[model samples]
Structures are given as structure tokens and as C-alpha cells.
Target chain A: MALCEAEKTFILHSVEENFRIDGRQRGDYRPMELETNIVAPSFGSARLRLANTDVLVSVKLEIDSPTLEQPKLGKIEFFVDCSANATPDFEGRGGDNLATEISNCLSSAYKSSTAFDAGKLCILKGSKCWKLYVDILLLECGGNLYDAVSLAVKAALWDTRIPLVKSVVVDGNKVDMEVSDELFDCERLDVTGAPIMVTVCKIGDQCIVDPTTAEEHCSGGSVVVAVSKSNFSTILQTGGGSLHPMTLLESLKLGQTVAQRLDSTLINTLKQINDNSTDVGFLK
Target chain B: MSKKKELVSKIGLRLDGRRADELRRVRCKMGVFSQPDGSAYIEQGLTKVLAAVYGPHQVRGNRSKAQHDSAIVNCQFSMAVFSTSERKKRPRGDRKSSEMSIHLRQALLAAIKVELYPWSQIDIYVEVLHADGGVYPACVNAATLALIDAGIPLKEYVCACSASLANNDIPMVDISHQEEMLGGPTLTIAALPMSEKIVLMEMSQRFHIDHLPKVMAKALKGCKDIKVILDEAVRSHVEDVGCSTGWSNTSQKIKV
Candidate 1:
């Protein structure tokens, strides 16, 4: 991963010309390949490859009592597992810190009710609720991990199907609920308000979205902006370097714009996914 | 007796319609990731595993672990939290995963020619994306393919498989999770297929001593079969790359 001064200068020069080293515009993203419903028996699953960064997200649901504080709202938990396959540096417990940071960011991004409606997951208010466990596995780390992880998580949530509750009966604190027996009779999560994150890197005083690993190395600082349908859900500055207030504002603007575009593109692809279609997963 | 009848059906088919000796269909691809020196993905029945090999570079972290006479082969075996029907609490650093890592290193150490690269280390990591049984064997096979992709020197291909006694008489090869649950005993073996040398052998549950030989042989046979399939994949992969690179390595492809 070491880049000598000459290579850094070459990258800097390319960025100044409004062209990235990969012949992409500054605001452009790498080609991405996405597949959904790959993990069997899970409520929903998605595998997204953004260049070399590979992410697999799966949603699993379990019935449980609602939290005392959040009585009416269901729970949504994000777990990120950075696999050692991504790099030798992530061996054993080495990747736990990064995994925690990513999961926390996701939690914050989805905190707003406008962004994600957790109330819909509640089954019987305080008595029972459906807990959605959104597990994300990072298989590779090319770059722009935040953006790729968010996209895959959004897709997985969209694909998740919550089984219909047939009936519920309560008798003297004893509650019994029957879930639907039919497999296909399930309700899909409405993900229209889900947030999409975009990473805007400051490379040589210019902001660029979707920075590759090499670009990330040459950049000074970056901001991750998670944008929902109407407003920015979360904005966080990462990496070691500092950013000026003006540049930070500029990066946020850029991130929000790019995130909007990315969200629509993702929705289009998700809609195109069909079970009868021959092209599904790794067969290609 | 009633439950035992389910392992092998009334006619001859087992669960998933495979005969006792038949292995689950194996599909694999090499060079899966660009960051690693070598990487591979493998699917055996419902189980899927990804393996990546790094180094023969300088030994990393705690130089005391380095060896002067031979390269150190470090291994880590981890499964995704959502890989199975139930969520796993931890991916690695658990007792089971640590044990798996040690077993994996032992199996690979037997085949890797580590003496040639003194003061260096090779790291083999396997991530199980799905677990339906035969996880150890899948990890070993995927690592072998990744090592081959890395152009590492090896005594021979090291492959592994799991087998079990279906009834009192029939021996099943490449046992799946369902079969392992129904069957009483499960035997797993890792071997240098060409030399027919057993690097590691493990048996869980009890089986008659007479049944041991047949089940072990069946698992070894499964390993040999896997090696052949892997060898074919390697050759075809090399040929494809050669064809793309102006056919200069045409002779090399033939030799393989």
C-alpha cells in the first residue's frame, strides 16, 4: 500500500485536471456489481462489490419483547464483521475497532424516525416486537468503505420481508402470537427514506466523491455524509488530517448531491431484481 | 431405528438425492480479490468459504515467532456471524475458532515447503460464509487453491473431506450438516492427495473399530477427488490467463 512521492504527485496532478487516475471524473464512482437474496434461509441478503470493496449484508428477524423505553418502536441493530479475507491486518480481533466504528455510524444514521421507521416493526407494543438484526460482512477493502457498506445495508433492508402476524391473543400476561405459515405471504420493508452515505475526500484542495484506496492515501481528510430523502442524516469527519470549515461545508454539499444520485441508481437496480431471472449471484 | 432410516432412504438415495459415495457438487473460483497475494472462493453443497493467502514476505509482528530454518505458516479460521441458521456471538478469538486455526495450520504446514523461505511468514486465512458441515475440509481445499494461485512451493495439493457411516454398512462421503446430525459418527481427514499421506485425522462420536477403516478410506477418496477437480480448475484458469496474454504461456499451460 506504499505510494512513493512520484506516484502521489501523479495522482495529485490527475485530480487537478478534473480526472482521476482511473480516468473517472472527480464526482464519479467505480463500477459496482450488486446481487440480492444470495444468503438462503435469511430474511434478506445482498452482496455488493464496489470495485474491490466487497460487502455482504443479511437481515435476520427475531421476535422479542419491546424495550421498556422504546415501548412502541421496534429495535434495529447493525453489526459489522470485517473479515480477515479483506486483509491480513484484520486477522483475529484486529478489525473489531473498525467494525464498531462502522456499526455505530450506521446506528446514528438510522436514528431519525424520518430516515427509518422502526415503529413499523413493532408487533404488539410493549408485549412483543420484531428485532431486525442487520449483519454486514466486509469481504474486501479496496476503498470508500462507508459508502459501499451503507448502499449494501440499504439494499438488504429493502429486500427484507417480515412475515405477517396471523393472530395474537393475550390472557393474564400470557401472550401467544401466530406467525404466517405461508412463505411468500410476507410484508416488505419500505426503504424509501433510508439514508445513503457518500465519502467526500479532500484531495489537493478539491473535493472528490468515492475515493479509491490510492486516492484516500493521497488525500488529507474526508467527510462521510449520510443523506436521506429530505435531509442529511449524519455527517462525520474521518482520517487524521484537518479540514477548514469552508471546505467541510463544500464537501457536505458534494456528498449530499452524490448520495442522492447513488440512492436512485440503487433503487433502480433493486427494482430490476426478479426471481425468475437467470442472472442472480456468483454464477456470472 | 426409526430415525436411522432417514439417513439412507428406502431405495438408495440419501438426503438431497445423493448416493452414499457421491459428494456434493463443488464449484470454485480463484483470484477472487486483488489485495491479497492469492485468493479463492469455494462452494461445496450449501457451504461456502473464502480463503486468502498473504506473504512469504518478511515476518510481521513479534519477530520472536519467526524461524530461521523454515518459514512460519500462520493461519486464522473465522466464520461470519450470520453464516449459519443462528447468529454466532463472535467471529474469531473463540475457543472453537482458535482450535480450527491450529488444525488448519497443521494441515497446511505438512504440505508447504517452508524450509526454502527462512525468516519469512505466510498467512492463510479462511472465512466461512456458510456452514452446512464439512467446513474444515472446505477451508483446507480453498487454502490449497489460494496457495497454488500464489505460486507457493508445495509438496503436493493438500485436500480434506468429511465422511460418516450412514447405516451400519454404508459409508457416506462429504457429509452435510443434516447427514452429520442423523449419522452417529463423523470422520474428517486432511491429506496430501498425491502421496496419500495423512496430515491430520479427526473423528467425532463413536464408531465401530471395523467401520473406521472404510470411513477413513472413503474420506481420503473424497480428498483425492477434490484434488483432481482443483487441479483441473487451476489448469483451465492458467490457460484462460495465457490466452488473454497473447498465448505466450501456451507451452506452460500444456505442461500443467
Candidate 2:
């Protein structure tokens, strides 16, 4: 939707005044509810609902050979499915494009060795490694999809437990590994330094942290920043418009600052979720 | 499949302890999401399915596919990778999923009054969150609730149920995943309960022609029982929706 000049100005003024149309400030996030270990059959699962947007993340683990290019590094892949439950527009293959876009962006953000150490996933160098398949399902789209998806993925990964391997033996080209029999004998991934993505929507002359559907439609462009604990992992500009160099630099600064707070809040919330609680799905 | 016991017997009751014609417990909630025009979640036994409806909008992609006489009914059947005992590689568009999607559309079209909105399109999406058995029937029932929640006109209530001939004698209704693996010829039927007409029917494995009449009749009876459960759910949902909208008026009267 192309907003008229008057509507654009009104939105910009509202953001500057610290009161959005949905009664949230520029720095305030929408009401969010999260639950973990909902998909019982998965290694780990989490579902997050931020206002109207809903995302379900499930993690599955498989044993596979490490990539030849990075033998020491195990693999982590992201698959995003924008289900038609979010909207009928996603029927059939309609959601494929959006799903691919989100998954590709996530892969780029986490592929760096320093960002997420895949080496920890290796049971035997070049022989056997744990491949983490992070599957995300988008059930509804209210707004701010990027933030909701990122949070759910991080929570699901934190809940994942990798079974401990007792022994590994290699015979020529054959590799054999024995996993621990005890159900509780497992290793948990250290996800304190995981990246959190924040999107800054530039509407008129103002930049807002979390934009609503109406504001998103009014914005001319937006910038997505994926920030780890100490540094920015990836920066990408979306939409068809170009931002001036100074404006782009300013937006990056905003994104990085917001992402830092987001990362801390997510870590604390996930810890509480790991304490064990029942999930109510969409009932709430 | 070798001769496994048709159903494990314990005091003349099947697994989970019900009569031969009994169905699994059904619990459902409608209008579950705000984004979709209509949404519903249903649980039958261990099977959980969510159905959502979108549109009466323009035909997406190639416009030529739109029919002039009636609105197009598009159906997509997807199961969560973790829904099964063994994880699935993909959710939809696979051979089984594609076939299920086609069958769902056929059964729904028979019930939906499509002539009311010509040249428009309606999309029904069913997501299986957990699959124990009889996923097709669960999906159809969930979709019917979602369509009503969306206020789409229907000719009649469409309900689906499955039946099986147990040990070549007793006819069982609402077979669970365990019963399905116990070696029996399974029959699934989707029918209009009011009209007493079958819209879609299918069978797996083999059954003698002489036994077909009894098996089919049992399946139809199962459908009728399911239809009553669904109708109750729809009525309760409507009451809830109406009360929420008239909350102020109702509250004022109570205060008076």
C-alpha cells in the first residue's frame, strides 16, 4: 500500500512523540508469549506469539559426514515454511519464495565459524557430525515477522539436547560411534552468543524499531541487522528504495543498539522457559 | 502383512477401552487465529489437526484457471515433520500429500455452495500437528469447522470417518493408528450427514465383495456420529462469538 504524504507525516510524528498507533513506543516491543518443547517428537521445539504473528520452531538432529571444505565444522541448516495458515496467499508453492528468503538470510547470519561454532557438533573430525536441522513454521503474520522468527529459532536451539557419544571407532572408510544409553546423558549447546536480528523501518523521516502492519506498508525502506553478543554478524537492506550513506549508518546504529537489548531479554526468557512449563499453543 | 490379531482383546474391549463402534474422544476449538479469515483446531484421539480458510479473493497466479460458473476450491494438506513417529523429510507436495489435497478438495466442494460466489477463489489449508491415524477424516472435519467459522455457505454438513472389518467378522469404527497396523482392510468414507450421500470413498488393502456392504454401512454410521459431534462444536462456537460481541449489552442487563 502506498501511503499518502499526509498519512506518512502523521505516522512519523507519532513515532517521534513516543506513542505509536498500537499504543507502543518506538523502543517498546509488542506483547509476546513463548513456549518451548511443544512439538513432542522433535529433539526440541518452541513456539512464539508476538501480538498476532505466530512462529513454531523445531530442531531435529541427524548424523552425517562433515563438509569437505570445512571438515572440522559440523552443519546447521535453517528451513522456513510460511504455512498457508498464516494466509491463503501461501497456499501450494506461494510461500516458497518468502520461506527461501528468510532461511537464506538466517544461514548467512549464522554460517560464520565465530557466530556459531559448528566444531562443537563434531563427534569425529571428517567422519561423523551432528547436523542440526532448524525448521521454522510461520503460522500467522501480524507484523514484525523477522524478530518473532529469530527469537523462536534461538529458543528451540537452546532447548535442543545432543546425545553424548560414548565411543567412536574408525576402520578404513567406515566410522562407528556408540551413543550413551542413559536418556539424560546429553550435552547442551552454549547459545549465549547467538545472533539476534532486529529490523529498523524507515518511515518518512523517522526510524522505528518494531513496525506494525500499517507502518510497514507506509515505510519506504527497512534495514535488518543481525547482532551477536559483541558484534554485528550481518547487515542487509530490504525494499526497493535506497538510503543515503548517513541515513544507512544511523539506521545501523539503531539496529545494533536494539539488537543488544533484544539478545539479553531473549536469553533470560529462554532460561525461564527451560525451567519446564506447559504450552497452550494458540489458546492464549 | 502376517496374521496379527485384528484387535487386542481385553474384557471384550479394544485398546483404549471402548465398544467396537465407539470413536475416539474429540475436543475442538474454533477461531483460533486472527490472521486467517477462519481457523480451527481439533484433536481426535492422539491426532491433532489445524485448519484455516482464506479468501473469496482474486484467483492467484494464472487467472485462466478460474471457472466462470463456480468459485474454485483450493486445498493444501501439510503435516508437520515431527507429527509422525518417524520424522518426515518434507511437509507437503509429496506424493501422499498431493493426493490427500486433491481428495480433500473433492469432498469439500461437494458440500460447499460454490455457486454463490462465481469466479472467486476460496483456499482451505489443513496442517496436521500430530498424526495417530485417520488423518484424512480429521482434516476433513477440521476444515468443515473452519469453513463455517469463515461464514461460507454450505449445502450440508460434511463429516468423514473410517471403519475396518476386524478378524473378518466384527466391524469396527474410528480405527486408531494401532488398529490400522493390526492387519485389516480399512474403509474411509466422507459423507453429507443430512443428505445421507457419500462424497468420497476409498479403501486400503483388500476385502471381499460380500463384506463390502457391511463395512461401507459401518463407515457411514461412523460419519453420522461424527457429524453430531461437529454440529455441537459449531453451535458452542457461535454462542461464544455472539456473547463476546454483545458483552456490554449482556452485562448491562445482568446489572439491572
Model 2 docking tier (incorrect/acceptable/medium/high): medium
Q: Put down candidate 2 lDDT per residue, A112-214, tens digits, no spaces.
A: 7777889999889877899998989988898788888888988888989999999998988988889999998988888877788888988777788878777
Lowest summed-lDDT stretch of 10 residues in model 1 chain A? A275-284
Task: Report how far residue B49 has shifted in candidate 1, in Å.
Answer: 0.3
- What DockQ score does model 2 reach against the true complex? 0.61
Model 2 stretches astray by more than 4 angstroms: A1-9, A274-276, B1-6, B13-19, B64-68, B247-256
lDDT of 1 by residue, B1-256 (tens): 7545567777889888999888999988888888899988889998989999998899999999899999999999999888889988788889999999999999999999999999999999999988998999999999999998888999999999999887677888999988876756889999999999999999999878988899999999999999989999888888776688878654543462
> Which pairs clash (backbone N, Cα, C closer than 3 Å) in model 1?
none
Candidates' C-alpha lDDT: 0.91, 0.86
Best by DockQ: 1
lDDT of 1 by residue, A96-155 (tens): 999998999999999999999999999897999999999999999999999999999999
How many residue pairs clash in model 1?
Answer: 0
